[model samples]
Target chain A: MKLYNYFRSSASFRVRIALELKGLRYEYAPVHLARGDHKLPDYAAVSATALVPTLELDGGERLGQSMAIIEYLDETHPEPPLLPSDALGRARVRALAQLVSCDIHPLNNLRVLKYLVRELKVEEEAKNTWYRHWVREGLQAYERELAQLPPSTYSYGPTPSLADCCLVPQVFNGQRFNVDFSGLPRTMAAFDACMKLPAFQQAQPSNCPDNEA
Target chain B: MKLYNYFRSSASFRVRIALELKGLRYEYAPVHLARGDHKLPDYAAVSATALVPTLELDGGERLGQSMAIIEYLDETHPEPPLLPSDALGRARVRALAQLVSCDIHPLNNLRVLKYLVRELKVEEEAKNTWYRHWVREGLQAYERELAQLPPSTYSYGPTPSLADCCLVPQVFNGQRFNVDFSGLPRTMAAFDACMKLPAFQQAQPSNCPDNEA
Candidate 1:
């Protein structure tokens, strides 16, 4: 198996976390997103969306979308499941993950931020504010959901689940934009708990082979 | 089951399609997004994100996020499954769905469009251009993926799957914004096939009770 990804992409970091959690080994194939490698025809052929974190299976089949890829990994591996066995619990965890993926991360991703400056002509500070605003609003929602659930070691249970895989990456990206983490207790607690694990540490940007800073 | 949703919301429309396809009976509970019904305290109590398209079960448990809600419905009611039986096939369908949900729809959703006008002060034409741009790019990608797969009546197979559940609503929303559909053959074909179905026709915004126009 080979993973085509960028070190700093949160979506890529998500698939990395899932792989590491499952103790799966795959060759790292870096596609530099900042350098516009994703737009190149070579990488475009490898991905339909021309996005990072495309997992090519050992049989040569490729899969994209971090959430979908993570779910596939969980389904195939099945040891230390990223989602709960029950239907309702799985829905709750998936909802938490989508709260980050759909609501927050999409607004602040590199392409969207680039558009804000280059296309919309938004100022630097205002762009950063836009990034922080969505993160804060999303984390507050996450905290609210967590308040409704029984306290667990991770996002939804004693072990790391799909929600934690998403939340940790978002928090990591948020910190880079100076997103305020003051009001989000349960959200931050989940992040702190995730960071204590070796899988999360290994999958972070700084530890990636293509890390620039 | 009861669905708290707005007629024109595409995410809400996705859940409606899934429920209709599964032949599940759900009471329509409208939360008008444009009128700010989702921001009210009552809606907030029903959903942590205060977003519409929340499915409240007979047991009083509520599920947010349309994708998660659809998946939950499929899991609990297994007949006429929205996903494929194989893991790889399921992954492909989900990737196609997220290509719209996470990429195109998020960029053009009501709140993001509102933020463009209110916060960024982007002009109306530019905002519409922004909406059309993301939708076109995403649908092109959807076309590319479909071209890779075998021809089918819907997005994935002879029957409507999760990909059609997502694609139909996106195409509907994109048409309202005057998104260019000339170059996307496979994508449009799938949308056309979906529109031919009774379930898709019944779940459309115009068919909903809360539809104003």
Candidate 2:
């Protein structure tokens, strides 16, 4: 298997965490988003969306979308499940994951930020403010949901489920912009717990071969 | 079951299609997003995120996030499965679904559009352009993926999978903003096929109780 991804992409970070959690081995194939490598024809051939974190199976089947890729990995390698066994529990975990993947990360990803600046002519501070606003809002929602659920070590349970896979990366990216983390206890606690795991540590942006600074 | 949603919300429409497809009866509890009903305490008690399309089960377990809610419904009631039986097939269907759910719809949702005008001070025309741009880009990506796969009656196969549930609503929402649908033959073909179904017809925004001109 081979994974084509950017080191700093939260979506990419998500798949990487899942891979490491499953102890799956894959060749690292980096597509640097900032360098416009993802826009090249070569990368487009690998991904229809020309996005990062596309997992190519050994059989030559390629999968796109970080959430889909993570779920695929979890299904194919199910010793340590990324989702709860029960349907309702699965729904709760997935909802928490989407709180980050669908709501927060999409608004602040590299492409949308570029559009805000290049197309909308948004100033730098406003763009950062936009990023922080969505992150804060999303994490607060996440925290609220967690408060309703029974307490657990990770986002869903004693194990790191899909929700933690998503929350950790969003928190990591939000830290870059100094997004306020004071009020979001459960969300941050999940992030903190995830970082303590070897799998998450191995999958973090700083540990990637293409990491900057 | 009860669905707390607003008519014309694409995410709400996605879940509605799933319920209709599965022949599950659910109460239509409308939450007027435009009138700020979602922000009220009553709605917030039902959904931590205060987002529309929350599914309240018979046991009073409310599920948030359209994708999560649809998957939960598919799991609990699997007459017409929303996902493919195989893992790889499921991944492909999910990727197609996420193309709209995560990439396009999130960027152009009501709150994001409101943020553009209220926070960024983007003009109405510019906001509309932003809406159209993401829709076109996302659908083009969806078309490309579909082109690579074996031609099917729906987004994945003979049945309307999760992909079609997502695509039809996105195309419907795009049309409101006059998004260009030309050159997306496969994407439009799938949407056309989906519309022919009675399930899709019954779930459309115009058929909803709260739908307005």
Model 2's DockQ score: 0.92
**lDDT measured at residue A165 in model 2 versus the true structure, 0 to 100:** 89
Clashing pairs in 1: none
State the fnat of candidate 1 relative to the true structure: 0.83
lDDT (Cα, tens digit) per residue for candidate 1, span A1-213: 899999999999999999999999999999999999999999988998899889999999999999999999999999889999999999999999999999999998999999999999999999998999999999999999999999988899899999999999999999998888997887888899999999999999999999999
State which candidate has the highest lDDT.
1
Q: What stretches of model 2 exceed 4 Å from their correct place?
A: none
Best by DockQ: 2
C-alpha lDDT (0 to 100) for residue A95 of candidate 1: 96
lDDT of 1 by residue, B1-213 (tens): 999999999999999999999999999999999999999988888998998789999999999999999999999998899999999999999999999899888888999999999999999999999999899989998999998999998899888999999999999998999989998888898899889889999999999999998
Residue B183 of model 1, lDDT score: 89
Error of 2 at A17 (Å): 0.5
